[model samples]
Target: MKIKDLFKNKEVTLSFEVFPPKTDDGYEAVEKAAARIAELKPDFMSVTYGAGGGTSKNTGNIAADLQDKYGVPVLAHLTCVSSTRDLVREVVKSYREKGIENIMALRGDIPKEGRIAFDYNHATELIYDIKSLDESFCIGGACYPEGHVECERQSEDIIHLKEKVDAGCDFLTTQMFFDNSTLYQFLYRIREKGIEVPVVPGIMPITNKRQVARSVALSGSTIPQKMKIMVDRFADDPEKLKEAGIIYASDQIIDLISNGVSHIHVYSMNKPDIAEGIMRNLSTIIR
Candidate 1:
């Protein structure tokens, strides 16, 4: 099932994201994570491509395995930061051959220690090229609800997002945000600017206190004070903290659905427990 069709109905849908493992020893574990997530029966599952498109092969493998063996629709991430034109073509064709039809096109971050090379900079160009190569693919693009970190302003970021939508992007997924108000404001901003494509709200529950710091540093998204108090209370006990974090994420997701944002994606970070906990909490609501 292409994600575009899934979102077209604008039905309440839940999805999970996973990533490929870097080492052979980690492969089994990561693959197991994918399998466990599949058991939860999300509408679809997405596997992440590593920085500079390094894990693309593994991404394809995992996605194909889930779709082929488990009958789950798999979305593969294809980053273009370091891939040449030929590489992009080959990757898309490989996905087609594997019978995978959905893709999350991305402009991955440049690696710090190695030489960076690529034929594209923004994800929009990659979106254009992918559409040209495979018209049937349901292309997904990333949107920053708080505005892109590198953008001059939110207005500028929406302008760039308009380009991607105009380039045949089927849907857009936002960067993870803790506060519902930020996303609601961003929705207003984008719709006002004529970029009204379906936006899947990306939710990241602060499962770990450490993730909160890193997530803010990476995306510059604000951490709300209410969540800060929750974290501060349970930050010491591992079990209590995990439970608190899952509940926090559940609340955010529930609020999103209540506001009629039907499509939601979890930045699960390959944690089945975290993802499962959130799903467990939402089972009644999502039902």
Candidate 2:
């Protein structure tokens, strides 16, 4: 099902994201994790594209499995920074052939070695290409609550986001954010700027001490003092930290729903245990 239509019919929607294995050896483990999460039956599940398309085939395979075997709707991610125009079209066609209906188009992170291809520089261009191939696909683009790390100013970032939406993005999903107030402010600014599509806030459950630095470094998300305190208190015990992290993320989601943000996307990675913990926390609210 197209995500836009899902939003129209449901008052609240919750989704999870899983990534393809980085190498062939781990493919079965990752697929098993995705299957377990799919059993939870979120409104939909999104399969992330690996950096530089290293795991692109696994992405399609996992997405197809989620949709066909588990009966879960899937959103397959496609990145264009490291791919050519023909490659992008081929991936889109492959998705269509597998019955995938939604795509999250992105101008992926530049590789450590440097970009290999320049066929597409911005996500807007990728969105355009996806639409040109088939307007029937529902495309989702990324947004930043604290502004994109590469962009110096939040205003400029929103301008680019508007252009992305104008290109053909059906909806926007934000990078993971720790504070709900940040998203509330971002929503106000985007709405005032006339970008009115449904914005789904992506939530990341920081289950361990190591994830804190890595996630913050990658996303540029500000860790509030309260979050710091939680980490400081529980950092020593893995189980305690995991529990605290789940609670922290669940609290964030409840606040978002309370404030009338109905759709949520959790960056569940490949940990079925963490995904299940979150669903257990929101059993009554999501229903």
Candidate 3:
């Protein structure tokens, strides 16, 4: 099913993201974790592509399994920064052969060693390439409510975002944000700019202290004072921190839904328990 179709009914939708393991030896473990999350029966599941397409094969395999074994529609990711145009076509072809209909197109993080290839520079270019290969695939692009780390200004980021949507992206999913107000403001700004696709807010539950620095460093998202206080209070207790984190994310989802944001995607990060915790909290609301 195309992800865009999932949003047409104006019904609330929830989805989870899982990533393939870095090495072959860990493939089975990652697959098992993805399966457990699929069993939660989210509206759909997305499998992330590894940095530089290192785990592209496993990404295809896991996405196929989720769609075939668990009967979950899968959105497989494809990153273009480190890849040649030929490689992008090959991956898109493999996804089609696997019965995957949706793709999250990304430019991916630049390797610490610097960019290895230069076939694509921006995500908009990748979006164009994907559409040229298969117009049937539903493409989702990433947005940042608090602005992307590389882009200095949110307005400039939105301008780039408009190019993606204009190129052929069916919808947009945001980088995770701690404050709902941030998303509200972003939505207003984007709508004013004339980019009107359904934007799904991505929520990452901060279950551990380590995730804070890494997520912020990667996303450039602001850590609101309320979130800071919660982390400080429960950072020491593993179980308490986990529980608090789930509740915090659930509250964010509830607020989004109440304010008419119909679709929410969780950066579940292959943890079935965290995914289950969020689902259990919203059993009645999502249904």
- The digit string of per-residue lDDT tens for model 2 on 148-243 reads 999999999999999999998899999998989999999999999999899999999998998989998999999999998999999999999999
lDDT of 2: 0.94
Clashing pairs in 3: none
For 1-287, candidate 1 gives per-residue lDDT tens digits of: 88888777647899999999986568889989888988898888999998767677899999999898778888899998888899999999999999999999998876677546758888889999999897999989999988887887888889889998999888889998888999999999899988877899988878677977898888888898998998899888878989998998888898999999978899888899988998899977776
Q: Report the candidate with higher lDDT, 1 versus 3.
A: 3
What alpha-carbon RMSD in Å does predicted model 1 have with respect to the real structure? 1.3
* RMSD of each candidate relative to the true structure: 1.3, 0.7, 0.8
Count steric clashes of candidate 1.
Answer: 0
Candidate 1: list runs displaced more than 4 Å: none
| Runs with alpha carbons beyond 4 Å of true place in candidate 2 | none
Mind giving the per-residue lDDT tens digits that candidate 3 earns over 116-154?
Answer: 899999999999888888889999999999888888888
| TM-score per candidate, chains pooled | 0.96, 0.99, 0.99
Q: What TM-score does model 1 achieve against the real structure?
A: 0.96
Each model's C-alpha lDDT? Answer: 0.88, 0.94, 0.93
TM-score of 2: 0.99
Q: After superposition, how far is residue 53 of candidate 2 from its true place, in Å?
A: 1.1
Clashing pairs in 1: none
How do all the candidates rank in terms of TM-score, highest first? 2, 3, 1
Instruction: State the lDDT at 119 in candidate 2.
Output: 92
